[model samples]
Target: MPKRYIVEVDGVPPSPSPISNAVVVGNQCWISGQLSVGDDGAYVPGSAREEASRAFAHVFRIAEAAGFSRSDIVYVDLAFIDLADVKEVNGLFGELFPEGRRPARTVYQAAKLPFGGRIKVQAVAPR
Candidate 1:
């Protein structure tokens, strides 16, 4: 049987709920939605782009912990409290992935987010 591994970001607190930050099954990893909760265990205070950056950082951290490289990530999903932040987040996204190396992306607007966060992000990587 293929082993299952739980992946967590170093320096980040475990979730208050039962959910794993991410899980690896064989060559694939499924990452849970992440908010910009910093090492201090508080939602980061900043612009939408800044918060989104930290959230995406969590996603990548979990991916790496699961033995997947940045380029190995195949898909990402993003949720924003306001659609106005999409352009800013897109700029950061372009910088992170760049051209042909970009992962498949889906974006949505949320009526509300936990911790009153501005953004939430998740990723998937399969090898």
Candidate 2:
């Protein structure tokens, strides 16, 4: 079996729940869902676009901790409380991944999210 390792970024705040921010096994890194919480553990208040941006920033932070970049991401899973927020989220996604390098993504309308966040994002990346 491949060894598994837990990964955490320095500047990111710990989750209130018991969860590793990310985990690495073999050549793959699995990042946990990230909300729009700040390093101070406060949920940032803003529009869907702002919240989504913050969540993605946390995802990138975890990816970096696992020795990967956003471009190295192979898949992304997003949960949004409002389906209409997808347009805003997609803009950020495009900015992060660009045209030809976008990762496979799945977006869903979640019934609710932790911390009253509008969006949550999780990613898988090559380590």
Candidate 3:
């Protein structure tokens, strides 16, 4: 079995709990859900679209920390506070994974998110 490694980014504030942003084993990385929280540990206020964008950015950051890129992502999971915002989320997805190279995705609505965030995103990438 390949050894597993925890991945963390410099300058990103640690979570209050003992959860790694991502764990890598062999060539595959499992990323934790990324939210719209700023570096100061506060939830960023914005529309669902903006918050989703930031959350995806964090996912990309974690992927990069694990020696991968957004293009390496094979799967993505997104949670939104409002299902009505699916269109906005899809737009951001199109922007991130353009030209029919999008990854497998599962999107749904959540009753509530940590820190009252509007969106949360997690991804799996294979190096």
Best candidate according to TM-score: 2
Across 6-88, the per-residue lDDT of candidate 3 in tens digits comes to 99887555677689999999999999998887887678989888898878888888889889998999899988888988997
Error of 2 at 74 (Å): 0.9
- Residues 1-127, candidate 2, lDDT per residue (tens digit)? 9989999788888899999999999899999999999889889979988988888899998899889998999999999999998997788788888989999989899998998888989999985
Please list the residue runs of candidate 1 whose C-alpha ends up more than 4 Å from where it truly belongs after superposition.
Answer: none
Q: Evaluate all candidate structures by whole-model CA lDDT and list the values in order.
A: 0.87, 0.90, 0.87
TM-score of 2: 0.96
Best by lDDT: 2
* Candidate 3, run of 10 with poorest lDDT: 9-18
TM-score per prediction, in order, is 0.93, 0.96, 0.95
Instruction: In model 1, state the lDDT of residue 20.
Output: 89
lDDT of 1: 0.87
Order of the predicted models by lDDT, top scorer first? 2, 3, 1
lDDT of 3: 0.87
lDDT of 1 by residue, 31-119 (tens): 99989998876887689889988988888888887888889888999999899999999999999998999999899999998889999
**Candidate 2: how large is its RMSD?**
0.9
